[model samples]
Target chain A: GFAELLREWESLENEYQNTQETHQLYRQKLEEVSKLQESCVAAITRQRKRLKDMSPSIRKCKQTMTSEEANTMEEIQALIKERPNIFFEMEAFLPKKNGLYLRLVLGNVDITLLSKQSKFAYKDEYETFKLFITVILLLFAFTCQFLVSNRIVDVLFNFLLVWYYATLTIRESILISNGSRIKGWWVFHHYVSAVLSGVMLTWPNGKLYQMFRNQFLAYSFYQNFVHLLQYYYQSGCLYRLRALGERHNMDLTVAGFQSWMWRGLTFLLPFLFFGHFWQLYNGLCLFRMSQLPECTEWQVVMCGSSFLVLFMGNFFTTLTVVYHKFKK
Target chain B: GFAELLREWESLENEYQNTQETHQLYRQKLEEVSKLQESCVAAITRQRKRLKDMSPSIRKCKQTMTSEEANTMEEIQALIKERPNIFFEMEAFLPKKNGLYLRLVLGNVDITLLSKQSKFAYKDEYETFKLFITVILLLFAFTCQFLVSNRIVDVLFNFLLVWYYATLTIRESILISNGSRIKGWWVFHHYVSAVLSGVMLTWPNGKLYQMFRNQFLAYSFYQNFVHLLQYYYQSGCLYRLRALGERHNMDLTVAGFQSWMWRGLTFLLPFLFFGHFWQLYNGLCLFRMSQLPECTEWQVVMCGSSFLVLFMGNFFTTLTVVYHKFKK
Candidate 1:
């Protein structure tokens, strides 16, 4: 019995020692791998910098070159263009500096993507969050339109919008840092939306607010519906295109239209245009209210200007995208 | 001249091709390294699971063994205790699931630390942010006490506190995932603080609010000062201990006392105990206000209970830590 017990004990101890050794070996290998990743990232960054530095000189050299030299220059330009794609796969390992928005909000905290999976997961979360919030906002607007006329309820809704847009802007910036191809205007759009909602939140409960409140809620409902439509349609398009190897996986579904989304989405054009015009109508209504003799709140004029800006940005951007798609 | 031009073009072409090749080679290596990292992490996870599964069996085996076998069992237990340390350094490369708080707030977004530097940087940012916000809160409380008594201002101040605590909780969770050894009660304390601040934010502007506003603001001012003091002293002690190799580098400075912080930090006990008692005092005040005939807001009783909970949790935890340290 003693011999059997000792054998079992020895076996367990042997297993424990073996597991410890294996763990230590893997730990050491992981450390080496981490170091190698760091150096590889550094090398890639340095190479990118060198290519960037040489680009202007190459362009200047092209001006005076023979035809043969021009062909080489063109090849060099093409290579440079394709360079980022070659290294894009390793971006998660690269050292990233915080963009201005992140620096302002989160200080110098590094929000670099650690792996490709985390990046995609974050992007998906962003999409789901946008979709989910759009639904909630639509419902809130519906309630505000029909059920309650309380100023407190309106203020709460406006605060929610402000908070939502603020969070969206921050998340979008992080997505951008992780190589999401979100255009600059969409990010700017979220910032403006946050400011607009914040202004509405501070708008005093008075004649002008009441005059514009119903219209604003109705417009919000319509806008949210359009946003939901765009998200579903655009994400569907992106998914198909990504699957077919025609679109970047990092492409995001934007609030406004883009040229790449034109293949089979013609039926959705009318809704987008109508929403844009509704924004224009809102701007006009607010401008009218701002001129009223009883209008004392600066929020009225501010909101009016913001609406006009949104209308112009959305309408023109959508128009440009459509025109370019037709021309192509 | 033509030959020289050809030569220059060829040299540039060569450089471009060489850069491209180097990039490709490094990219391939990085991919392999990433794969290695994944497998290594998987292995570590598997090993940890195995050890955990074997733990109960080992304990059972210990009770029925001879004295020599018991000594062997003790060795196994000690090895198990030390195994986590061996693998701790590789945690950044490990797959981390979202904690409950992060899951509820941010969905399933991955907040894993990618490297040691980022973890330390994020920890430092958290400390600096806390320090910065504490100063701002202290000033706001001072203004609320002597300079301003407007309900709107008070509401804004309370909202800031709510936002601050909410953010701190999220950041602290991230830090915890990155291997910081912050105790559980501190995180729970922030949750309670966020709730308290939110309840204060929603308390209506009324006679009861007016009665408690000054006292709350005064308590806030003192609490912030004590927080600032604890931050400075605790961080100083942690810094010394960490440098001396006597403390884990990921240790955080908490709002209340910790056992390891007893050396040369006896002076801070009064301030911490005073703050804890002040929470009790606030709880009592709010209870009195809630009992008044004119009081109708649910916020009063809710805030009273929250303050009492916070006081009890803080006082008992600190007392236990102190008692254990002195016994040692």
Candidate 2:
């Protein structure tokens, strides 16, 4: 019996020792892997610094060149202009530095996309959120237009718009930081939209508010419809282009048209122009309202100016994109 | 002139080739590093699975053993209970899966901390945010109590509280996903606080609202003061413990007391207990108001119940933690 007990103790000891050894091995391997990862990250940081330095050095070098030298270096100039894309591609594994907006809100939290899959996944989520919110906003605008006369309901809808655009701006910034080729104006457009909705939210329920409410809701409904249509068409185009190696996979379905979106999406142009004109109409209405003796709220003037700016930005950007595409 | 042009071209060509080769080498190294990172991640995932399996196998083995055999395996059972800590340490470099709240809100975005420094930095940021908001809330409450009685002002203050708690819950969830050892109840407390603030925001400017408004503001002011004090003390204690290697660096400063917070924090007990009782008093006041004939708002009863829940949770958790610490 004593010998049997001793044997049992030895077996348990062997199992315990094996478990400890395995744990030790795992810990050691994890430590080494982490060290390698740190070195790799440091290498990336160093490379990014060099690339950043390269731009300034190239610019300085160009300034020292003669006119003839500059002419001869035209190809180099073009390549330098395309350096940002190359930098983005090379820094795919590096942790992204937050933009000013994100730094202000999230306080420099690391919002890096460590893998291509994760970056793509985040971009897809942004698209889905946009699509989902657009549908809800469309339905809500419809209800506010036809079924609801209550100020509370209108306030709720405006609040949703404000929140939606705010979220969109944040998501878009994250996408851009992850190497999404979203142009600057599109990101700025969301900030303007957010401010417009916020002003709308603060507008008091009065005769002036009542006068413009229906038209505003109607415009929102129509705009959301156009957005839905654009989303479908642009996403389909994007999918095709991505598969054919013609577009970056992270390219988003923006609110306004870009030159690249001209192919097979001409049918959506009329609707976009109509929405743009409606924005102008809204601006004109607000401007008239702000001039009225009874209009005392600063929100009236602010909303008018915001709408005018949005109209000009959207209209001109779309026109330029179309004109460029037509010229080509 | 032709000779000079040829020399320039040749120099440019050499520079371009050097740049290209350097980029190619960097790309190759990056590729290799990422592959290694992926394999390391895979190994961690497998190890986690095996560790998970070990628990069940140990349980099954214990069930099949005689009482004497089970008695002999007590040390192994203890080690099994400590496995979660080991697993967390091992998986520090792995991407974290979102908790349910984050999944519902952010939809499975990767919130992984790839380095220990980032994790600690995030935790510090969270503490700073809490402190900053606590001060703002305290000042806002004081103003509402002494300087302003406008319903709009009250609504704004309540909105700030709701937004603050909502943000805290989201950030706390992120911290938990990143392996901060925040207890579950503390996260749930923020959710309840958010709901409470939301209810308060919806309460109309009526007789019942006026009845509870000053008391609520006073309580908020006092609670925020206690939070500020607790933050300073807890963070100091954490800093010391971290320096002494007695605490994890990622541990956060929570609102309520914990067993580990008992040493050198006995003076904070009275303030905490008083805050708990103040919650109970607020709950009782709301319950009494809700029973009045003029109480028509559903928010009164809801606020009453929420306050009661907060009181009970805070009181019991603190009591149990203190009791445990005393026994130890």
Candidate 3:
């Protein structure tokens, strides 16, 4: 019985929709006829008024209201009464003009888009998906890096870090020549935002932070590593410039070289100083841990390992720069 | 008698200096004349060879070398025997063809210097000096940040980091547009030594590394912070594009908005998720420390204080973004 009632109700809804649509069509036709009748009657009336003042011969011709004219006037009146107002038509739906300013300022997205024929960025949805997947996997690689404990893992990870840093620096140099010199101010701005975001994510009231707090150091380290890579990038670029200049029998670009140096210095100096103090503290921490009977071998290993990696990376990077110059 | 001998020795040294300078000048003149004479001879010889190989009339005339020509030839031979070959005249040290190429490839740098000027970057002198100063200072700051015993200092220093990062990013973006739109690549390539000179600072190794190895986390934070800021910058630009589209009744730009959102998502999501984990770890450390008997008041206060600053700053930034979004 319930099924029958539901079916009946659905049928009723369909019937109602059909009836409403038919009624609307009828009303629209009626409105159109009424409007036509009204316009005809108004025209005839205006002619009758003019007929009152016109000469008799002219009046006998155009002034005489024929039955056809009377019929047309009646049709106009009927149409006017049945139809909707002209102004009420979907006039608001039409596009408005914000004038020439918008046209000048904005690019036509349709023109610029990477559709079937056009090639621009953000096209190839498949590629985006693949890129995103790769990025996710990379993030996972970062995760495994911190979570695991082994000498091979440690060595491999730091090596990877160096590689990543070197590649990024190289990329940046390429960009610098290409005119994508990321300046000091921009880096500073992004740094502030990232720190703030980290804090926000970790806020006590937030669930995200509730699951992740102590990892701040590690996470921050990874982040800073990327940043350092960027720094080296600009530096390495300048390095190439010097080398290329020599090859071409040109004097080194003294001024441009210096500017890159300044920007790079600002980034490196603070980080190096921070790392220096950390080394001292880390050494002290390891020493203090030694006195504690509860200290585990793993704790000592972590301390010893991080310190070694940190120092080695910094030392070799500096030495590389010097050695490169000497080699040159 | 010893004083008299010393005076005589000094007089001999002065006389020697004068004689040496005179000899050097004479040698330079002889070298110049000889080189010039050789080039002239080569040019004349080549011309004579070509003429001799050509119609006999020209060859016969060449055989009867003029008295003036013979005189020039004799003078050139004498000087060539006495002097060394120099490529171009010293006044224009660079060969004319190569100099013109360098001038066209790069702006005039001989007259323009790396100094306080309208240079795209800090001039060369300031660059090296600034880089040296900042790197040392940055190493200091990085080290200090790790101490984590002063809340106010951490916040203040982070703020400074933010400012620098911002400057860097802005410069980078401008470089991109400049490089592509105008022939600014030439300027950058010429001035910056093809963008390589600005990146890695070569230095004596151990000192720089030993100084910077300690405070890895702080440096890492600064780096991550910059990436987050990039996320915001990309998003903000897209948001404005959306606004313009809506205002101008152009629905096509909605695609642009989608792509921008996609970009920001890729940019920030990693940091956000990674940061989420760190925040939790920090909390655990903070909480555990609070319960520990060995925790110093300074350590507790500074750590707690750093958290508060980060939290507040993040909250305000979120609020700023939200408020602007909904406000008329």
Q: Which model scores highest in TM-score?
A: 1
lDDT of 3 by residue, A1-328 (tens): 3233335435534643453444344335434433443443343344334333332322244344567654644554454333223211111111122223222111110011101111112122212333343354355456544575432333233323332332233222222222232443332332333333322211222222222223433544544564445445544554555455521223455556545655665666566656545544554555565566654333243443455445445545555554654453
CAPRI tier for the interface of model 2: incorrect
For each candidate, give the TM-score of chain B: 0.84, 0.80, 0.28
- Write down the TM-score of every candidate: 0.79, 0.75, 0.20
lDDT of 2 by residue, B1-328 (tens): 4345446446644654555555565455545545555555565565556556555655666666777777766765676566567657755655666777665455556677656677777778878888988989998998999997887687678767866776777788878777777777788888899778866765656799899988998899999999998898778766666565545533335313344465546878899999999999999999999889998877789899999999999999888877865664
Q: Residues B179-232, candidate 3: write the lDDT tens digits.
A: 212233323322222111111111111332233223324534543464445435
Kindly indicate the candidate among 1 and 3 with the higher DockQ: 1
Q: lDDT of candidate 1 vs native?
A: 0.74
Superior candidate under DockQ, 2 versus 3:
2
Estimate every model's Cα lDDT from 0 to 1: 0.74, 0.72, 0.37
How far in Å is the alpha carbon of A247 misplaced in model 2? 2.7
Q: Name the lDDT value of residue B183 in candidate 3.
A: 32
- Displacement of residue A117 (Cα, Å) in model 3 is 40
Please list the residue runs of candidate 2 whose C-alpha ends up more than 4 Å from where it truly belongs after superposition: A1-81, A104-107, A139-163, A188-220, A246-260, A277-328, B1-78, B104-107, B140-162, B195-216, B248-260, B280-309, B320-328
Q: Interface RMSD, candidate 3?
A: 49.4
CAPRI band for model 3: incorrect
Specify the highest-lDDT model's number. Answer: 1
| Two-chain DockQ for each candidate model | 0.22, 0.20, 0.00
Expressed as tens digits, the lDDT of each residue in A1-328 for candidate 1 is 4455456546655765665555556456656655665666666767677667677777666777789868866776786787788667556445467787665455555566655666667767777888998999998999999998887688679768866886777788877777777778888888889778866765656677788888899999999998888888877775665455444533345313344456446868999999989999999988998778887767788899999999999888888877865664
Q: Number of the top candidate by DockQ?
A: 1
